[model samples]
Every structure is written in C-alpha cells, then in structure tokens.
Target: MQKTRLSASGAGLLALGLLAGLSAPAFAQEQAMDKLKSMRVSGIDPNLPLIPQTGKNADAIKENLKRVKMPAGFAIDLYAIVPDARHMAVAPSTNMLFVGTRKSSVWAVTNRNSGDAATEVKQFAPSLKFTQPNGVCWTKDGFLIVAEHNRILSFPAAEFFYEGADVAVSEVVPQGKLIPVEDESYNHGARVCRVGKDGMLYVALGQPFNVPPREKLKAFTEQGIGGIIRLDPFTGAKREVYASGIRNSVGIEFNPKNNDLWFTDNQTDGMGDEIPSGEINRATKKGQFFGYPYIQGKTRITEYGYDKDPVPANTTNPEVYTEAHAADLGLTFYTGDKFPAKYRGGIFSAQHGSWNRTTPIGARILFTSLKADGSADKTEVFADGWLDPKTRQYRGRPVDVANLPDGSILVSDDFAGAIYRITYTGI
Candidate 1:
C-alpha cells in the first residue's frame, strides 16, 4: 500500500510539473526514506482532504466561553475551533495561526477580515501523519517548524502555502533521530519549540518518567533527554544541549527584550500534592542545570540518594514557584500594545489544571509582573472561571498562549478544542 501511494504521489507531482526544478539533497533520499514509516515528500499532494471548520463542537465551545472571566475591559471570544490544540505559531508574514495537537493533526487558522475572529481552520499537509505534533513555531523569515515526539519538520512559505493540502515540506530531524529509541515513551512526549534571536530553533524534549531514574542519568544527559536542545533549522546540524535537568517542559519562550530563555518545568509527583512546586525557570546562559532527580524546587529527592553525589554547585534554582501540581504549560511575554501600559512587557502563562489533586487548582491564565531588573515582582490570576467552583469540573483547559500582531493574545484550549482571542477594549 505504501509503495502504491508513493507511485501515485510521484505521478501527481510529475503531472503538475512540481518536479521540474527539484534538486537532490546533500544526504541521500533513499537513506532517509528508509527511516520514515510514514509518507515522505518535498512536493504537493493534491489528493489531500480539508477538515470541516464548523460543527456542533465549535458551537459548544462558544457556549462555554460565556462563563469565562477576564479583567475589566478585556473580553474573550472564540477565534477558531482547533481540535486538540496544544501549541501555536503565528506567522510573521501573513498573520496565519498554525496550531498543533497532541494527536496527529496540525491546523492552519486565519482571520480573513480585520477586527474579527479567525474564520478558517484546516488540517495542514493532510498527506503526512504526525505523531504527537504538539509544538509549532515560525521563523522570522516565514518557515513553519513542527516538533513532534521524535522528529521535526520544516515547511517553507507555510503562511501562503498552507491554504492547500501540500506546502513545501522538508525534514529537520528525521523520525527516530531526535532521541534514542530505547528512551521513547508515550508519557511526557509532547514537545514545544521557539526560534530564538540567534535564529536557532530551540526544542524541549521531556524525559518520560515521573522522576527520572538514577540509572538513566548519564545517558539522558548526553542525549538531552530531560533538557532543551537547540539546532540550526536550515540544516538541522550544529545541535547542542542548551539547558539540562528539566523533567518536562511543555512551554518555552525567549524574552524579547533580553533574549533570555524562559520555560515552565513540571516537577516530581507522588511526593505529596504540595511538597514540590512547579517551576518557572530562566536560563541566562547555556549549560545551566535546574534540579530534577536531585532537587525539586529546593526539596531534595531523598529517593535518589543524592547525598552521596551532591547536587551540582552551579545548579540554578527556579526563578519563580507555582502551586504544586498546578501544571504550568505555555508562557509568553506580553509585548503587545492593545493592553494598558501596566501590562507592557509583563508575562502571561497558561496553567492546564491539575489532574490528580484532592481538589483541582489551575484551569486559568496567570500574569506575572516584572520589575526593572526583569525579575518577577508578583504573579496573579489574569483570567479564570474555567473551573467551576461549585462543581470543581473544568469547562476549558488552556495549553498555550500566542500573540496576534494587533496586540491581542490567543489562548489554546485542548479540553474545549478551541482557540480564544483575548482583547482589551478599555472602558
């Protein structure tokens, strides 16, 4: 069946004359083709189908938005219905929003008119099936990079080409190459990525364990299993581990003002619901390690017997601590003009609510005010009411936050399967 599809795809490309100027890669295509279990291509696939944009699920999400709350003069509205939306990338050239999901699909969202919500949402490159493609980010020049469980792919001119089934696509990290095969697991596999000021693509790979076992420490460190790694997106080389000792980081953003890297790390579990707090860390320099198996938010993990092997002398602690088990995921610096002056250059993060606390705590948006030195002065709830106080049930769970060019911000909800636009219209 795979061979048949390849033949047809090749025929389709020939018929459309897309192969006229195609050039071979420095690496052999046959060598990489052997590694891909799914389809491989660098051309268009006209047979791909479009996902329906409107349905009952979208309507239900709209109704749930009625109960959502924000600060004074700020309103939340449904931007688009993107099922299983986990991370987002807003295009620099076209303002198109590409959303990723925990499952197989990546959606391209667009706002056709000014001062309105996104009207179109469709599957991106329907011919390819992505595994846990939860991280999406765009380069300054317009390449859309999607980070999956163990692979990364780049789409050139993604903003303009995404309207069709096939956009020019190529591999950054081929399947079975991002991590060692022995370490791959279903848990903690969602990846998030961002393009830094230096133009390197930084991707976070979460180690798949509640507490990273002591036996795997050496191997994990070498492979960046529990850390963030940066690579040249164009050639996928010049790769190096950027930060280490992070257990699971689903959200990462570079401070636009200083180019400092910030990420939210989910800490150890089963150590009481409130002992180890979730961490928001700042990486001012490369090679900085945040405690994981050795220490979690100042509380050392006695289980690993780190007393014999003391924690690293240069281990950097978290910049801020969030409520234990609150599950802080996506984060971004508020660098938009739509909000009031007080919010300029502040931080906005999404807490995706706890799964197994005695009582749930986080289905809301958090705001952190920064002091002159760029340190966090205070953190407060910017938006809430996603969790029903009376029932303790979640109406929506925000996974990631992205900013629109007009100064409005977008919140993606995997539970509600929608992207919501938050705009501040002062009274």
Candidate 2:
C-alpha cells in the first residue's frame, strides 16, 4: 500500500508540505521530547500564548460551549474536569474512571453514579514514570491494569477507594522486546490496550518515527515491536503476536457480536495531504501484515524499495479511509437504545485534530454506519466545530470515546483537559 495521496485543500496543502519539510529534520530526533513539552503546555495551539504559570485555570477547561455542534435533539454537556489528563479508561463494574497524564501519574475517580460528578479522585502508582500511561483496562476480577511505555502495571481496583491501601498486585514486565533505543523513542503514543473476549490482554505498540523505513525503523517492526500483542492477564503468560505493521493505532475495540478486533491507525507523514489517508482495519488473524513500510493505501512506494512485489489486487485495504491526518483515536460502536434506530451498531470515532497540517482537521466526533459484516458505509460527522477551520485554531482535541450505562457517550479532550457527555434527547 503506497501512501495515500495528499488531500489538503489546494494551496493549503502546499504550504503545509513546505513547513513539514522545514521542521521534519530539526524535530525528528527530538520528536518525543517536543511532544512531552507540548503536551505539558496542553498542546492545543502552536501559535497561541504560552501556557499560564499559576492557578488551576492554567490548564483549565475551556468549554467553547457555544461552538460545539451536534445533531438536532442531541445535547452535549460537561461530564468532568481533570487537569493534564490524556488517555482515560472506565471500569463500569466499579463505576470508576482512570485517567492517565503526561506527568507520569494516573488518577482514579470513583463514586460516579448516574448524573453525579466524579465524587472522589486520588493518585496511585505515583512512583511510575518514564513512558506516559496511555492505555488502561480493568479485568473481570476487579484488577486495574495500565500500559506504561514498554511495560504493563496492575493493581487492585479496591485500593483506588480504600482509605487503608495495600498494593496487592506487582507490576510485571512483559517478556517482549522493546524498540531498541536508548531513550525508548519508538514507544510513541503506546495506547489502545484491552482485554479481548478470549480472556487475553491486548496492547498496541506504536512506531518510533512519522514514516520510517527498514534502517530508521530498526528495532520497531523491522525487529517487530509495533502493532498489537496479546498476553495473559493474570501472570503475564502466553505472550503472542496478534498483528503487525500498524503505524500508530490509538483507538481499538472489539465488535460485540463477533469479538473481532478493530483499530484506527493514523497514517504516516511526509506524503502529500491526501496521499496517505488514515485507516480503519480489522485484526483478522495473527501475523497478518497490513502494509505500513511496504505500502500506504492501495499504492506501492517505489522509493522505499517496496515495489518488487506489487500490492496484490486482492490485498485487504482499510474497511474505511478517514480524512488525512485527522488523527483518529478512541472508537466504539453504538449498541444502546438511546439514539435513533439507524445509529444502532454504528461506529463512533474521536478525531483529535492535526498539528502538522496547514489547515486544521479533525477535533470532532464522526459516525459511520457499519454493515452486518462490519464494513463501513458512508461516514458522517456526528459532532463538529471543535476547531475553527478558517483560523486553523482548535477549541478542543478529543482523544477517547466511551459510552455510559444510560446510552450517553463521553468524549475526552486532552487539549481542553476535560470530558463532554453527549445525550440524545430526540423522540
């Protein structure tokens, strides 16, 4: 699959390509470091004023409440506020919400009854740092597990609320290879881990650079570290390679009906705007390669020496192609009764917006109707106006999506440092 063709709006795409070339080399080696500083400053606007020095509002939640757009009869409201929170996970059994941060700590919020604010918040596993905790999931037995850099850590869900705390679980370093770098650069975004229906834990390991080839991609897929991996939940046993060749998949979910895995993978950069559109892929089998360094979409890149074996005519392409650099993250299918009948089994994905593009894209929630076989139909914008398309300024960047028991959806914004609840009020 060669890279998707550049799809930016005419002149804007040209300017963006020039800017990316200028910054690529300077920022390439320091990409992770740059992301860290930017994330700490909320990473919303590159041209805006620097983040404030003092007060809770330094990184306060900026609602831009009026700017939000949704379908008729659908109401969007503030769900909760947590400063510096990035990827978040919910444990419905215990009604607990766990939020990960760039500052190397995880906050657990409990007592989240219906229509009530998260009543209690506490920080556990304070000593863990290095890779930001990007993905989190809870086991059937009430164990709270988190993915931090190259390792996974587990603790009891009870300890999150218990005044007298005892750390019952020990962190287990998986018997897998890290992306051999002194600074762990290949561990970018390390998000999207979940316990599959097969009773095994799955984790996504991202690539190091924007679009690295064999030499630059060594130890990270060249040596096979990127893509998804499965491990035993309790003892960290039965480690197996689930899939490979994914660039950076931040959002993943299992289809409730068939238990098949699906993920949204952000495309590689340097290609023109539309050349390499992001993808939604179904993880059908173990060791099934989805291109990556070989091909972008259905096109083959000759420059990377991948033109030898032409992309097969029958090769599997994305189930759907999202807008280029929309930064798709956090996907879930609507299975609840609150929304319209047409929305049943529809896929909802959070677009975190794009920074490298000349014109801003994403920063909204999109809905896609899936067929009975789980293939995508026409994709539509479920929510929008998170970013001012003309000014290229963002009002928010949604990172994750989850549904409440009452059928409402929760979207988490790493930029605004808040979460928004969307409820359908239509008859």
User: Which candidate leads the pack in TM-score?
Assistant: 1
lDDT of 2 by residue, 327-382 (tens): 88888878788998878788888998886776668899998887877677878898
What candidate 2 gets wrong by more than 4 Å, as runs, is 1-63, 111-113, 158-166, 174-183, 215-224, 307-309, 312-315
How many times do residue backbones clash in model 2?
A: 16
Worst 10 residues of 2 by lDDT: 42-51
Query: Candidate 1 overall Cα lDDT vs. reference?
Result: 0.85
TM-score of each: 0.88, 0.79
Question: Cα lDDT of all candidates, in order?
Answer: 0.85, 0.69
Off by over 4 Å in 1: 1-55, 307-309
The clash tally of candidate 1 reads 0
Task: State candidate 2's TM-score.
Answer: 0.79
**Best prediction by lDDT:** 1
Model 1: per-residue lDDT, tens digit, 1-427?
4554458878887866654435333133433333332434435445545445567876877888888878899988888877888899988877578999989999888877755577677788765668899999988888899999989998888888776554567889987899987888999999999999999999999999887778999989988889999999977899999999899999999999998899999867787878688889899888999977788787777676764668888889888899988899999998899899888898899999998788888999999888888777788899998998899999999999988889999999999888899999887
Each prediction's RMSD to truth? 7.8, 14.0
